[model samples]
Target: MSERATPVKPTEEQEREQSRETERPSDGGADAAGPGPNADGATATEPVTTGAEAVVRALENAGVEYAFGVQGGAIMPVYDALFDSEIYHVTMAHEQGAAHAADAYGVVAGDPGVCLATSGPGATNLVTGIADADMDSDPVLALTGQVPTAFVGNDAFQETDTTGVTTPITKDNTFSSDPDRVGSDVSEAFALAREGRPGPTLVDLPKDVTNAVTDREPDEPRVPDTYHVQEEADPEIVEAAARRIEEAKKPAMLLGGGVIKGNASDVCREFAIEHEIPVITTMPGIGSFSEDHELSLEMAGMHGTGYANMAITHCDTLIAIGTRFDDRLTGGIETFAPDAEVIHVDIDPAEISKNIHADYPLVGDAATVVEQLREAVETSPKAKKWRAQCQQWKSDYSMAYEVPEDEPVQPQFVVEALDEATSDRAVVTTGVGQHQMWACQYWTFTEPRTWVSSHGLGTMGYGLPAAIGARLAADDDQEVVCIDGDGSFLMTIQELSVAVREDLDITVAVLNNEYIGMVRQWQDAFFEGRHSASDYHWMPEFDKLAEAFGAKGFRIDDYDEVADTIEAALAYDGPSVIDVHIDPQANVYPMVPSGGDNGQFALTEDQL
Candidate 1:
């Protein structure tokens, strides 16, 4: 006899089945003769399966080797299944962190990253990260637990209508009403999240469905056609774009995240060099073009360098690739590149005229479009004036490192030291606000997708979890560093446990200033130091918190300690948190101060 596992204790409904087999459910029960054939020649399968088993089978079928999420009552079954399977689940401190981590994972892996969260608050907390992925078009799958289906509309404990809440945010949303279909739902969710115009997708599961048992067999998921994008780009549109580039005298390239997503960085760089044109990147496209390249200008828009903004404004022809012109980058659309004749090339057709109008719209894969552009530009004359203009701009506003000769430790110094120590090869994730902006300005990333941050969403507390995901996705030899603010670090500080549990040797450098630095900076600048209670002098010691979570911790008081602390953290086998105290009253200058006019910056007599 085949060795039968112990029968699961039946529910009261199943007890009635024991008395009369005929009264059992019609779908898949103990007495059903295999499965009935459906209209498509496929057999009708059981609709009841453990949520944990479904999660594992679905992930395996989706070819996902790992995911990141925190374990809670609603998500424990999925976690248990992950534990049993070959797949690794890196537990994190908060749901938003996991989502950001998933975004980073997608950036490096070039595939949809998966994240999980419990019901109610857990799902709600992931909204910001979801919105981030949505705005940036990052492929991410978020699984959330829900109260049992029977109690879904009753506001049961820890339950929320996650499907309803995430519907507008996600590309698609689904709830598991039947256990047998859970794997299929997950497969579709992953496919929809990754294919065509990538974004976030949600799959909500009920608590009881996770624990309940049924006569169900897991099967490999099939990829459906619904998720794929239209393959053809308009030939007429491509020809028009080629014509524009050939005729233009002052053409420039504006690279964005889509190039990275399409792995077209090499193609973009080649095109830029061949035409002798300048390349200005969005925040997401920082590492796409080498900072050392003469034709590569800094990022444009708010927080961008002055030279980049000026170059974009003066360019007669703009070749925008793989990016939507976000408002933050455009400074209110009307005044953005108004004089430039834009050639918008993107994989997503919806992004063509969503914000800024495009004179020549080329819709296709970024890599494919770059290849076409390369072919088209083979005969075009080199634009020497454009190259000279770009060089002059770079030379004019070359990123300056200004500091007092005998000043105490500055946040920029820490970033520079960390960059030097890591040989500038590490993937840096950052929390939102001024420190994040500082890292962007200070760090010189040499490779594409090296910086993982929530640019569009601007979510705080995104650094640690994103670093965790980056470490998992990147080469085993490379280190992952998190640049966090004291306020941001404390918000999701519990993620240290995940790093410890998984033995991920990641480092978090906390720029502590005993206050919410960004808000405090605003208060110091515009609000006249009203402060509004941004101080957190009584906050828990980060060193102690790291120790509590089974990781190493250190405090850096002197400038010399920055490199050593980072080195020690990188060398350690477990996670580490380094808390560095900076001047609490310091502010990030070059301030527009909200409502200020362009090119009007407050020059500080001395940068603190």
Candidate 2:
């Protein structure tokens, strides 16, 4: 039997303190305690500490290592406090870059990454990153400095409703007006950001509140009362799911990012191997299962491997673990796995039937549920023929691309070359577009958390900063590479300066096609080849741009120079950019048309 441990109940005194904290105003104000001795043996009348100090102390108590952001006028107080704290602050070139760096930091570090921004445009600039974190379910804490509390409603300079603006994008948002509650507010923000279905959380700190003095001691980090303790799936449900699997002729498993979030990759792999189940993953789920495994069907969806999509399309029973049936994975809802009976396991009950209906909805953490399912399930010979058939499909429809003999380089070849050079040991990050799809398809990931990208939001300008953050969080010798498209790289090109200043050894590989490649492909297929506003006209020279940012740059126009340039860029001690010109007319093949089923993929040029 799986251990069913419950959360420890709070003591009476602790309960009373929590109640008092809850009743405190959203606007910053004094706590219920007067100027007396506090629980930590410190007198309330003891030398008051600034709210900024208290915020730093709270983050320290919560075990945050780095804070990523650009220092601004309104947020200078926190920066001042950071000077005295143990936390390292990474100064990014832009607020959006900072937010993305924080998000990626959280992903690689396995903790909530913190970002600080000022009010008004500074806070607004973080919206894209915040939304990206929210969509991808990454835990990130965004701290925004606001105008003085007194001037909040007066339309003061740099004033904005930071909490109001971020409410929809964050798991929770708070406006702190009282210096006394800064510690508690920040602590809660960290907890909420990580608790159940992790996501971004925002805390709005008014400048006046940050400057205000407080006597409150920083509390030890504790699980928020609202957080639900994860439990193993019910025995009966696990048994029933096992029975369904035992009875099915063609059983398959679908993995997602949740498997990584729950740290269940090993157990998931064990279950798949034991049952001889073929595994397919979503975009963010790329590394959840080892691509080299025999049963691994790299990724299944639009732009997925032909064999993987075929497996998902033909499988009779699908055991979906921690994956939400998003539109990208499910080409068209009506035709997706039409004959399969899904046994869905997710931590969030709301996600169980939110998209595709689940025949067995087992609500628990992926690690716990997968373990229970493994224990309940018995080896069945029924799936032997099915596994053999899937293996044949994998051999027959393996991913393939043709390279022209001419000079123009193909983006797929670049990715394949990087894969060969890196040997799958480097942490790979990418911006959205054709480059992202190519990275997902070509790069073989053998470990979890090695592949990072903006999966759900599909945000461009994510690669550079995310690679910076990933490099900082990774081991000293781990190579970090960002494969970005020309259009995507330009979106956050300023981050090149941040990489140079930090002396991070990261390689940025730009597939420069001189056009919005993905958009151009769609236009070519559906818009009668009318390429309007898609071409770049060769505006900015990327190698020069990298050099201008104090980083080494190399341009590869000929196919002969691709391997050496990539190797040289990787060998550089500091940041470097390798701009390889790809065929402008090339397109990502094996594409399922919008609203089309997985079976409706256009594999060859004639099909398109």
lDDT of 1 by residue, 1-608 (tens): 11111111123534423422332122221112212343344322324247567766788667786677766778777765554443445556778878888888987777889988989898898888888888778889999888878898897888888988888889888988777777678888887887777789888988777767744654454446655665445777777787778877778789998888778889899888877778888889888888767777767666777667777777778999988988657765666776789999888888999998998888888888778777665466457777777778667766675666466678888888888888556788898877888788778877887888888877778888887778768765577888999888877787777667656768888888888888877776667779788887977788778998988999888877777787887676668888888767656654433433224333341322
TM for every model, in the order presented, reads: 0.86, 0.91
Candidate 1 is scored at a TM of 0.86
Instruction: Give Cα-based local distance difference scores for all models.
Output: 0.75, 0.84
For lDDT, the strongest prediction is 2
lDDT of 2 at 79: 75
Query: Please, what are the lDDT tens digits per residue for candidate 2 over residues 1-69?
Result: 111111111235454345334421221212133222444665422444899888878897787767889
lDDT of 2 at 151: 88
Number of the top-ranking candidate, with TM-score as the measure:
2
Error of 2 at 193 (Å): 1.5
